[model samples]
Target chain A: MKPRVGATLASTTDQTTVIVVRWGAEDLDVTCGGAPMVDARGPEAGTSHPADPAQQAGTVMGKRYASEEHGVELLCTKPGSGTLAIGGVPVPLKDAKPLPASD
Target chain B: MNITVLLDMAADGFGDRVVVGTREAGLTAQALRARASAGAALVEAEGADAILHLAVNTPAFPVALFAAGLAGVPLVPVNYRLGAEQLDHLVGNHPRALVVADERQRAAIERAGLTARTPEEFLQQTRTPAPHAVEPREVDPDSAAVVIYTSGTTSAPKGVVLTHANLVSYVLGTVEYGAAAEDDAALMSVPPYHIAAVSNALTNLYAGRRVIVLEAFTPQDWVETVRDQGVTNAMVVPTMLARIMDEPGLDRSVPSLRSLAYGGAAMPRRVVEQALREWPAVDFVNAYGLTETSSTITVLGPEDHRAGGERLSSAGRAVPGVEIQVRADDDTPLPAGTSGHVWVRGEQVSTAYAGGGSGSSLDADGWFHTRDRGRLDAEGYLFLEGRVDDTIIRGAENIAPAEIEDVLQRHPDVADAVVVGVPDEEWGQRIEAVVVPRRGVDLDAEALEALRATVRGSLRGAKTPDRIVAWAELPRTPTGKLVRRDVVAGLAR
Candidate 1:
């Protein structure tokens, strides 16, 4: 499914949860811990498949996971053992520089 | 979706860091959350639907705000500068509200037969854990998060309602979560009632920046506070920046300050020019928006300030996720450089009022009529002429001419009165009134002073005319409608 902005996703394998902040591509399979994460509101929001040990590196809350190559940004609203992946490749955590306070 | 998400994320992300007040003794993210939870218990016990903040900027302000969020209530921060009757009228809006008022304004709150707690008492009360702590309730994003009362062209003040969705969208669209460095602090000089104050609290906290408040503004005190506090970022109105730049022989050197944002009114061209020379190291940003639009919709970034010469006067381009356009009265889009009413559409824009309001401001196409006259350059830089409505914005406060005019016309000796805003170096616009005297009465200098005093007697000091002049007649159309531009031109002459 094409992940829409503001759509929350929870890991089926672990406690990881994320909100899609920005999306640039039309179709991309977003996964965490080698398991396809389900919509937070869906019945399969958790525990569909066991997390792959190799990909279970974990995610930190409030840290953004983004793949420049894949054109996607996901903010880790809730952290867990499952790491975020965009189409099977683990996305790097690269935070953008702080803009000057405008308020 | 709720604003609590931001606070919760901050608490977990950096719970130990002092996100508010002095670095030595401010509330940490975790402490703020605990206090908010404790405060929520109090709110639920009182059965209040809203939390009214009738005080200056304080640490307790944020506590009350989050407490309302946690308890599923809206936080209504009102302008304390208003007159007693006005204050009472606004306080009456929420009879079942928990008011955090200053000592001076407590009587008005009490007069309304509502319970009022001083900010200190509120802090003290929230410090203790309630017998039964209320859990964070899942709030509807569409519900009102903040209601601010602002006087527009009409004499009556209408409450502008901002939902959690609008605020959350503003933060999510503009701010990167936990982006501030551990030492980054922002000094806020704007009053608690303004939209900037609410947005600043949410955005700065979400960015992990420490928040500091300047209750009283003196150019000397402001400069020294930045230096003493090691404040990295700050927000001010145009007047504050103007005084800091023009005040001769003041120690203005601040090595710690990095960014200074000025807004709330049209920035004087001379002030902006001098400030650029005075503090070349500081990243000066010009943010322009209204209470209806959840703070900043357009921003003149630091890069544009130095390079863009003529565009310095411009309010700059729209921020991300927001679209800006210039349209005629007929709702047709205007071409570049043609001045017309400014219209904006975004996730952050809230056209709703506390009640249904006068009428729908949003059109069938979903664009909000900003009621501001401005033209967009080919590059999309917005140059604002002024507001289409005759609301006079003096510094940060919006004053209705009709409100003061009604008072002037009430005096027995006064025949006719028209209050208008005149451009000034200090105040972006100063209030000036032209009066027509009663038949056979002398409209002398004394009479002008008397008329000024008459307005002061009826209204607040901020609403009183700064200068009053006597005129034989006022320029009006055949239908007897005011020709505001002509009056302004006559005042200039």
Candidate 2:
């Protein structure tokens, strides 16, 4: 039988969301915007996600949904121009860089 | 002598009364013999050298034994609770062994698609002459009689070899210690595949006692059985004992119970104390052993239950003919009061493992290193601290899980408990406790923190748990051993 998941949401916003995904099955693929969020290279990395991710994000309209309702935040900026934060108090995002959308 | 001879002796002693079987299908001596004749014919047709019997709680066990004995084939009882992979490994490893199962186990056999025969069909097809021409094989004292796979608590299961001599010795030893008599009656709830259950059966058989076997134990049924049957003795685990003690009507229901023998895992002092208070007339025995020893090696008798005495925290002294020693990591024997790995040597010790197993757990010097850490008091009583593998390294200090489990169980709200060490980068391993609260009791972090405070007050820092996770029920093996590793692994995620 599949184990029941017990998770409580930290916060959620229109641009980004942070949900506690307590991983019941191991080595699970947890994704944000169809991109992997957890490292899957070590023995600890199972076929399923192991724990609830404290952070998750995506781009919305022209502004990046950097910081969601949760404490976790995402960063968007041009190289050498510092960074931009759209939510949860604007601040310079550390090591922020921009890239073109994948084909 | 062959086990058949022993069965015959029992049949001769018990006569038409039930020798072995379930309540609905109990068999007398004549019926048992008839079934054996039928089973022998079926074994001949199957083209298998031996029979692999698999049933958790069947009345047909004694009949199967008799049939195998008459057929001059070995009977290996497989634990039904094991997974498909484990069954595949055992069956593939023992190609010559044919499975004899009841309807309940047919699906499992078919899933593996292994060759198997139903108990009824085996009886029908194997019906032939007494096969008196075939004499029972002489059992070598050191040879394997049954191969019981160890619970894969730390690793995969390994088949433990138990010789007939070893089993006989253990049974005889228990009979002597427990003072079992021919008139005694035993109530058993433990499964037969486990060493303790089998040993209990053997002990009863040797004494010509009437053993009322329960298919399994429910709290209500257990209490009713003891009360109704006037059961003189019972073989139980700590969990079963706790359940019975907590049962509402238990005080009046089990008044007839005279003796309660428990083992397979350590019992919490509070549970033991409750049992003692509820059933003051019953003698409580603490037995310690493994499948490798065919059952018991050390027995702490009822007299050792003295509170605030030297034997209070001990597992008890070694039974007659058994020797226990504590050895350091270097294998050097430690003096009394020094804690280390507990080693044992006795008449009941199995010579080796089955299925090409290799280990010197039993060294050349004849001592079997039990992998349990404990000290011997000046009075020669043994105290089991915990398994060497279960030890947790918190910072620089090592902690034994049993010490913490004992403390947690003493809490008024805690009904059952198991302690495990989880991996932690900062401390190497941190102690975590999984607790099952008493029925109808509600507990929260604040209550657990209070419980931890009680532990600290009673046992100081070493026995305190780092974290407590409340569970509805602890996962356990079919034999009722707490699955500490699985619990810890589950919590780690």
Candidate 3:
């Protein structure tokens, strides 16, 4: 699927929803619970998919999942029992680099 | 990109953490979200076009900010210190606004014939659970998030419109989400009307830090609050910093204060030096910006302050995502170290003013003419000379008041100083100064002579002040910005 910053996506195999925070150079094969995600209009519209037990690693709300090789960053907007992956590779939680807060 | 999304992120990232007011009684991130939802429901029910807050910085302030976002109404924080007639004039402009004001301010809001709520009532109403849950509406990132009236020193006040995307861009570029330690707390002293206050609320919340507001600021009270709250980070304007630094009775020691950020106006070199000496361990940041720039565009970080040299006087380098350039009268870019008009371009710069549809302030290229005169050093450090409008033309030579003011500040007996151009028959304009003497120092004729000689020696004689007057205190806006118009009018009289 094509990744665009601020675009919301919902898992096809679970109730996971995420927003792309950063896009990569190429289209991403992003998936959750062993199924590709699709554009989500509302919460109810994305929750009917059943998760595959093998890929139910779960996603944490507000945590950012990043693929370094793909240069993509997705922020979890809703928690679900679905592991977020890109091209069958599980995405790692992006570490926050604390900068001096500009207020 | 909507401002509410930041609140949503906070609620999701640290739902149980206290993010507003005092930690013991403050609303947690989750609680705040619910309250804001209820408040948004109220706003929608009322069909308000805007949420105007005429109150001091308090717990309700942050709630109103988020609620307005959720309601898709721009939040307008009016200066609580405006006089009756002035307040009436400003409030009258927002006839469709739902005003949340303090007790004393209710009369003005009523006079404007608008719906009003007290701070307590606002809090309670926002906290009251709705009979049925109100679904949040999708907010356009380009929509107005906040409308702050510029503190007009030389002309009538104009509203500066900051969009949700502008603020979100600033926060996303500057802060790492949920970056603060679980116990980290920020002491917010700037008034709610100032851009610093609004930006501080959003950025600190996004960083997962609790914010405690000081309703009124006294040097001793600020220090005590920092100590009492175990505040790790705090923000103050230059005037506030000067007061805190010079207060002889202050204990001046805060073990928990890890970072102190100051902006709003030019910081005196002496004040910064004294503060460094007083608290060597604290990280001091000198942020330089305007309301139109969404708070800060450049920052002199702690490392630069620690190194201490000419850079201490600079506004530091431009922050990531902001590009700054100095331009000449012909709009050509000036060479490095050559002072000229400061121009900035960034995602955070607001391109329009209220009722003034995209004025010439923003060029076709998206670059905003800051109307500030400054120069970037060879190393890219920005040194603010003064406002372009503040230039004093003496016999065809343009002189910046900041240059003379800096020299006056170097005087040991001078506590504060401001230089302005005065009408003169001989020269196009003559430079005049207003000085606040240090406490207990009698500024006699001999001392005045010494001050004049100091300025003449350091700067050209034409650039020196033609006349100097003593004032107990200069006229300043609520946010500590010098009201130069008042000073000039007073001098004229």
Candidate 4:
């Protein structure tokens, strides 16, 4: 893998988007719609892995983002169907528009 | 009543000699006195009540001395190895004490819900344009000077009471017998919170020799320090010495080292032999004592080392002015060559224990019955068999585990050995040996059987260990004393 930049997308065709924010050192701060979300992995999981998206969705209802900055990995999840607002900015989902058929 | 006066007098008495050295700080007797005077002034200005010293292996020990001297209060050197619970116990036990600690220990102290000042803050409080000086006090021979906590075997740590006179006696005895001179420079890598380090520092200071203190012991750092600093003498436990010897470039690096003083635990014969071969010119002394005695009461000198295996097996004769004897369980004195309780009486013996008053080990007759069981040869040399409590009673016959462990440690494949007695229905206790083999050495059941056969051929049938258990390493105290109780408890688990 080339090391994905954002929170893992669900089914590759979902209109929802998850964006990750990176911080200093090894700390990972994962937030969704201005609220903190528990990473997807089990409670005993390493900070890098969020194994259960459903469990995290119940805890934090929003779109998500995951990013690596300064050696620190962050995963953020956002909520809603169309445009998601995080850190006072709106991010539109690419899957919201229909894709053209290829030969 | 004043410690500064005594230090000043001592400094004047022995001038132009090196007193203390850290990698960053080096001071002669005159310089140390000057620095101490400056530090003492700071303590006076700060209005500190008591100095709670938490720096165990730092070069800032002199600051503690200065603070204690100026404040005219007790210096409580807390062991850093303790957890917050134990630290809280110590703090609650001694209230109104000003804490002196380094940056690394600040969080722990804070976590323990205590406030402390950095050494810099303490110095700032006592800073003076011209350092105020005080005369050394005429300390009572029996007055408590230093309170050291014992490495507790079973219960919480207890403070050992050592008086100035007791320390003075210990220093004089060791210096005189060990032939310490002003030209000598001793390296101290052991933690300053330990009695060994404190006693060694005090003795070296009194002798007007330089003391080079290492923050911690690393084989490379030890070798480099000895060579670069021209260190002549050092005190170490057997495990540390063994590790240093195992370091790749130790022999070529530590050529300037002259004397190697071993203590904390009995020196295995093989380790001593290896040390002798590696550092042929260095004088190896086996020091035997406890926290109560300050440092060493008996010293097996270099001449004894030269005498080979037989002498190596003994803990050596008592140092001058110290008398030693063996006593039975009923307090009756035993004849020479009899295994019994070891009793010692000397000026260096502590007058009492903190919080509990005098210890029961010290009788009205003035003799302190050390719980160690040992015998004296015809030449008056003391041979420590083992602790009386550690003796295994197998089929009604007492077997010293140390005796067997000593033999096992001599095997070529064995790196270390510890012997314990497990519960047995018939014998009451059964002998079990725990061994750590040398790195990369393969030891199987047959090899262990052959080693047992070797032991069987060398020792009596009753002394042979019934079981041999190989381990990666033995559990040790922070000060490097083998944890026999922990080992036995591990076996039960």
Candidate 5:
């Protein structure tokens, strides 16, 4: 699916949800828990594949997953038993670059 | 598109980090989120339509903010310093709100006959989990996230409607996520009702910086807190800066202070220059914007101050994703170096106000009429002349009081100055000024005459003040904005 900033996506297997925080201009294959993520409402009930062990590294709520090569960032809104991947490659968590605190 | 998304990200990114209050026992990211989650459940259980925060800035303030967002309702932060009649009128507007207030503000809540909770009690109630995991609804981007009341210096206060999109755009555009150093702490001195307070709360948290709020402000206390807390960044109004710069026999050293931002009113050239000289290691930023614009649209970075000269007074260039223009009365675009009405169009700009729907002060093309008279230089530097309403018409010539007052403030004897237009049978309206001379210097005729001559030398004779009086101090809002109406009445008296 085309990855866009501020767009929400939901996992097919479980209740995992994520929002794209930053992304490059080009479209990329973004998936959660070994299945293609659908819109905020998710896909029809039975269309999802059963959770796979290799892809079930599991996601923690509120963690961010990013692909530096593709310049894509996703914020996990819900936890699930699936890893975030781009083009079938597992994406690594990106570290935050701290700014001077200005209130 | 709910505001809670920001909080959720923060909790997940650094759940154990202290994001609010003192570093030792401040509320952690996970704690804040849990409190907000529990508080949202309370809001739902009470069936409240909105959350009305009528207290000073506290740890509970941020919890209430995100809780209200998770509850799918607007958070209305009202000024607690308003007069009885004004306070009553504003309180009456929110009958279905959950009133969260302090002891000093309990009267307004009691008068409204609504169930109220103190900040401590509010925090305690949110400690327990609800029957089920409270999930925040997917709110629309255009839903009202917060409604901030204007200072109402010229007229009755009106609620400025800021949607989730307006505030989210501001944070995402201006701030990078988790951008603060692990030990960085931000000292916030602005009041709870100000837009800076709301925006600052969210931005500082999202940046993973610990926030320290000074419920009350005094120069001594502020400096001491900075020194003790090792605060890395801070924000202040012009008056607060002036007070800090002029505090007598005080230790002005803040070794950890790296960035200081001043806004909410025009900064005198002398004060800013002194600040830059005294704290050479510190970076000074001049952020210019309004509540309707979601805080800052233009920023004069520290480099501009080092440039010195006339750039000292310039409000600097627009921030990213924002466009600024100067327009004549007929909506014609003005050329650079020509003073006219300032207009701004941007995603962060909230062109909507309560009672009046979206696009009230904005044109059909989405440009918001700032109602501020200013000029843009060829390099895109914005120089504010004053408000359109503050212009003095003297013999058909539009004279900006800020222009004359700026010159007056530069004088060695002048500590503060304000120029106002007094009704006159001749010349339509004559320019009158009130000057607050430096301490220990009497406002003698010689000093007043020298001020008049100085203004006359730089500006046209018609622009000079016809009558300049000496006042111990001028009336100003709590946020350092001059009360022009009060000044006009003072001149009349």
Candidate 6:
């Protein structure tokens, strides 16, 4: 699915949820624990899906996972024991440098 | 994209951290979240479309903001300083709003035929169990999160609508998650109506920092609050910083202050220099942006202040998600160092006004044309040269008033200065300046001529002010923005 920015996605295998912050690639194969995620606002959001235990690397809340080549970024809203991947390649956690608060 | 997500993140990440009020008796992130739920219930019960904040800085400000997101309504913060007529006109726009007003605004709220609650009353409501259970509702990202009315120079004030997407993009792009230490606190002095207040509340809370509100701003009160509250961070306007420097008989030592950000208007070089010398340990940031944008777009960091040459006067580079472009009168893009009109484009920029008034709206290309005339240096640092409308157009040449004003302010005898264009038969417009004298020195005939000579030495002869009038003080807004229209009217009289 080619979801827009600010779209929320949830994993069926567990209580993993994320908000899409940036997107560029046309085709999306976003997976959590080897199962495709569904729209968080859809009826199937919290339903159970088949899971593979080997893909469980865990997603952390408040951590941003990104893939530079695909230009994809996601902010983890709920922690779950599943790695977030696009087309089966795990995205790395982005290192964040804090800026001085300038209001 | 809802702003409530930030509150939820803070509550989930650092539930026990104090995020609001006094350090001794402040609300933790978890408590604030619960209060937000109850506030949302109150809003739902009232059937209000908006929460109109007609008061000063209070804890109710944040509660209403978060509650609005939960109820999928906009938070409209109106300036309480407006007169009766202006207040009535503004209050009319939001008839179906739950107004949280102060005691002085009682008559205005009553005149509008709306029931109003005090900030204290609203705070108390949040403490008690909600009348109804409220589950956090997700709002459309494109919906308005805030509506801030800005007083214009020529027309009635217009409301700048800030969307949830705009605010969320700004917060996520600029701040790192969980950045603040356990004990870090921020002292907020800007009024609740201003975008600085809203932006600061979101940024500080998301960073897991405590925020203490200084209801009204006095230099002595601000200094004492910083020391007493253990404030590690603070934000102020140039005028407030100037007053802090000028105020005497106060212990100005702020050892706990780690960062100080000042903006809303241009900073006097003298005041900035003195502040840097006085607080050598504090990190300084010069933030520049408009109410149309969420908050800051360009910032001169602490390292830039330490480097401190010509860039100190500049507005520094654009923030991560924003792009700045300089264009000529013909709409052609200008290269670096060429002064022209400034245009900006970013997700955080909301160029649209609520009820269309007179102002620049966003173009088809998503670029918001700013009234400012500025230039970017070779290294992409922005140097603002006053407003384009404020530019002095002579027979042919367009002159910037800020250049002359800077020179006038630099004169030893002059404490403040304002350069304006007055009507003239020979030139389309002639340069006129108003100068305020330093405490002890008299800006007599000799001193005025000396000040003119200083401007002549720096700029060309034509750029000099033809008539220099001495005034006790120049007119300005509370945030130090010049009331040029008022000044021109005063000069005409």
Native contacts present in each candidate (fraction):
0.61, 0.00, 0.43, 0.00, 0.28, 0.74
DockQ for all models: 0.48, 0.00, 0.42, 0.00, 0.25, 0.71
Cα lDDT tens digits, model 2, B64-123, are 655665666666777777777887777666666677776777777766667677756555
Give each model's whole-structure lDDT. Answer: 0.83, 0.63, 0.87, 0.66, 0.86, 0.88
Q: RMSD to native for every prediction?
A: 10.2, 29.7, 2.9, 30.3, 4.3, 2.0
| Tens-digit per-residue lDDT, B1-493, candidate 6 | 8998899889988999989999789989998888888988988998999999999998899999998888899999998988899999999999999989998898999999998999999999899868677976767888899999985754578899999999988898888777889999999999999899999999999989999999989999998999998999999998899889877676789999999999998888877888999999999999999888899999899999988878889888888889999999987999998999999999999967887764547887889887899999988899999999999987798999999988887676777889998888999998989988877777888778877888888998999999788888889877778888777777888
Candidate closest to the true structure, highest lDDT: 6
Give the clashing residue pairs of candidate 3, or none. Answer: none
**What TM-score would each prediction reach against the true structure?**
0.78, 0.75, 0.92, 0.77, 0.89, 0.96
Q: Kindly list the per-residue Cα lDDT of model 3 for residues B1-493, writing each as its tens digit.
A: 5788889989987899999988889999999999988888888888898899999888889999999998889999998888798788888878998889998887888888886788899998887776666676667776889999988776777889999878987887688778799999999989999999999999999889999999999999999999999999999988999999888777988999999998888888999999999899999998999999998899999999999999999998887679999999899999998999999999899977877874545888989998899999998999999889888999999998999999899788899999999999999799999999998888877778778889999998898888888888899876788888788898998
- Residues B275-357 of candidate 1 have per-residue lDDT tens digits of 88888998989999888899999999899998858888788888877999899768899999887789999878886888776
Q: Which ranges in model 4 have alpha carbons more than 4 Å from their true place? A: A1-103, B1-6, B14-16, B22-24, B38-49, B66-71, B111-114, B119-138, B176-183, B249-252, B358-361
The sequence of per-residue lDDT tens digits that candidate 4 reaches over residues A43-73 is 5222322233332232122212222223322
Model 3, position B256: C-alpha lDDT score: 98
Question: Candidate 5 regions off by >4 Å?
Answer: A1-7, A10-36, A44-102, B357-359
Off by over 4 Å in 2: A1-103, B1-5, B8-17, B21-25, B28-47, B69-73, B111-113, B119-133, B176-183, B249-252, B306-312, B357-361
Q: In candidate 1 chain B, where is summed lDDT lowest over 10 consecutive residues?
A: B476-485
lDDT of 1: 0.83
Residue A34, model 6: Cα distance from true site in angstroms: 2.8
In terms of docking quality, model 1 is acceptable
- i-RMS values of the candidates, in order? 2.5, 33.5, 2.5, 36.1, 4.2, 1.4
* Candidate with maximal DockQ: 6
